[model samples]
Target: MSHATRTRPARTSASARRTHTELLSVYLNDHLAGATAGTDRARYLARSCRGTDLGPTLEAIAGEIAKDRRSLTDLLRRLHIPARRYKVYAGWTAEKLGRLKANGRLVRRSPLSTVVELEMLRAGVTGKIACWEALRQLAESDERLDPAVLDDLLHRGHRQLHALEELHREQTAVTFHASGPQAPTPASRGTGAR
Candidate 1:
């Protein structure tokens, strides 16, 4: 290949770049809103978890999640991606709704509740890893984002996923195996009902 081609950045028309940037900004913001809700979940878990083993760990994870959300907003500012308030509100509302799901019990806490929430947190962390990876790809071409920062965010996402997965396993085992190994029926499973 010619040196010019090898060294030259991939080219797109100005209009195309603008359109792509606009789309990406919206997409990132949507995911940012989701991440915001994930932080809420972490905070809720930290507060609601009464178990001696999971409580402190969940609190620490909640702190980390808050930091991650702050880092994301900072990145958005650096990129000139305007924050959409409505999306943020929507995310918060969704998290609140998630809390109302039935978890085998009517008025009291259920072990299954923790298991389900942990799984949701794990899913969010998975998405966070993807978000960081997407931005890391742009870091190669976009000057506003630091590759090192994205790398750190990705690393933190991995750590969050690891912690969440551990909690998920422990919670599921505790929730379903209270007696012994048994087949989970529809009612016994996470159907959000008794």
Candidate 2:
């Protein structure tokens, strides 16, 4: 048979195609879970930091995060991938549990809280950048994936990361370097000469 009549080596069986889709669905669902947690955390941090230097920036980033999550949901729907609700619930629960961390304050927001939360948000944004890039690669072969949309998401993720890093640094300095009360005591720093 001629090259044109060779049937293109069967073009992957339907079962194999289904498996591929299933795996992609699972991967996207995992990211969706992370997105849920990140969105919740961002909103909380924004609210906590309200009236401070980081307030407006954190609030803006939180809104962008919610928008990103929606975009991911839309992509899943377009690809006919059903989101696993349990994973999303787990994400939400995890964010809630994160608040229980001891930050040297029992009744009020610790300075440490802002620093740590910004770091976590930064990490989430980094992951989101990776996710968008991965989907962008798939867009080359999958008509359901949109390269332009993925590119826009990637751009926003980078912007988010930069903003988070700035907030993290500012909060870190305030939390770790102040002298009024939150500063580390000399004994807490150990008696050894330095």
Candidate 3:
């Protein structure tokens, strides 16, 4: 082979670049949908737990999750990716439907609700962490992605996960180890009922 031929750099076709961007658009939109659900769930959980021992931490987490969703939206705009409103609406609807699950209570909030919601929030945060890590990797090649922003997001996600794990452990212990079904106190009565 000629030296020039061997030394020449390979080129990617325009179609290949378009395909890559299209795949990335799909992936990010999916994450945005999940983030929408997560934000809604976090806000709902925080409101339910208001005035409880976990209230402040949950409120903080809800705010952070909302901010993260905004960041994801901004990223989508920067990449010229359109937000799929249908996916966002589906996510919102799914979270609302999730509330109808049987939590062993009909007219009141159960301790099991806290445990289950915390578990769900933790899982969502874990997924967010994974998305941030994927973006961090992509930032190495994609000029539109900022490594600094991705790193900040990753750090916040890990912190959120740690807080959630602690809450989940405490709630699980309190919910499962009780001697029997304790009646709600007057102060607790009707507080979290939705």
Candidate 4:
């Protein structure tokens, strides 16, 4: 190999040399132990990285911040990146999280149908209680509704009454494959001569 090819190139201009020296000093200062640069510094680095490849620029700036000590979180914040936790509803099975429509119909599945039914029951019971109190104060009161029947109200709407009256209406989307495993057929006993 030629010695010229092996040797580092000399800076031809004093201005160019100054820039290189400054860049190197920043790198070393940030690289040193216990030297922490703030978000302002990181922003400057990201801004300086424009018009250049992001990977190399980010890497170079990251090197200046800390060779191995800086956290990705710190770096991102320094770049003025906002902290926003995305609400992803993709493929999650959490009940009441989605009300997606599909196949020209809305559908709901039971995770705790009894609990939801009970909540509705509680509301109805509360209303009934209020009415009973009012009626007792007045002259009109029904003796049939024992007012203490809230305990059994949870199971009151357990049956499919009136084709989906939908006491606590909820909905979500789901995808499923129709193809199932093929079943093996039994051998013919007559042909095989039992």
For residues 11-121, write the lDDT of model 1, one tens digit per residue: 445667889889988988898889889999999988998566899889999999999999989999999999899999999999999999988999998878888899999
- Report the lDDT of model 4 for residue 158: 26
lDDT of each: 0.88, 0.91, 0.92, 0.32
Q: How close is candidate 2 to the true structure, as a TM-score?
A: 0.87
Better of 1 and 2 by TM-score: 2
Poorly placed runs, candidate 1 (over 4 Å): 1-12, 180-194
Q: How well is each residue in 1-194 modelled by candidate 3, as lDDT tens digits?
A: 68667555434456678898899888888888899999999999999999998999999999999999999999999889999999899889989999998699998999899899999999999999998998899899889999999999999999999999999888888788959798898989889958
Q: How many steric clashes does model 4 contain? A: 0
RMSD of each: 7.0, 4.0, 8.7, 31.2
Worst 10 residues of 2 by lDDT: 4-13
Model 1 root-mean-square deviation? 7.0
Model 4 residue 75 CA deviation in Å: 72
Q: Which model is ahead, 1 or 2, in terms of lDDT?
A: 2
Model 2: per-residue Cα lDDT over 1-194, one tens digit each: 68756655555566688789999988999999999999999999999999999999999999999999999999999999999999999999999999999789999888888888888899999998999999999999999988999999999999999988888888888777856567567777776678
- Against the true structure, what is each candidate's TM-score? 0.85, 0.87, 0.85, 0.18
Query: What lDDT would candidate 4 get against the real structure?
Result: 0.32
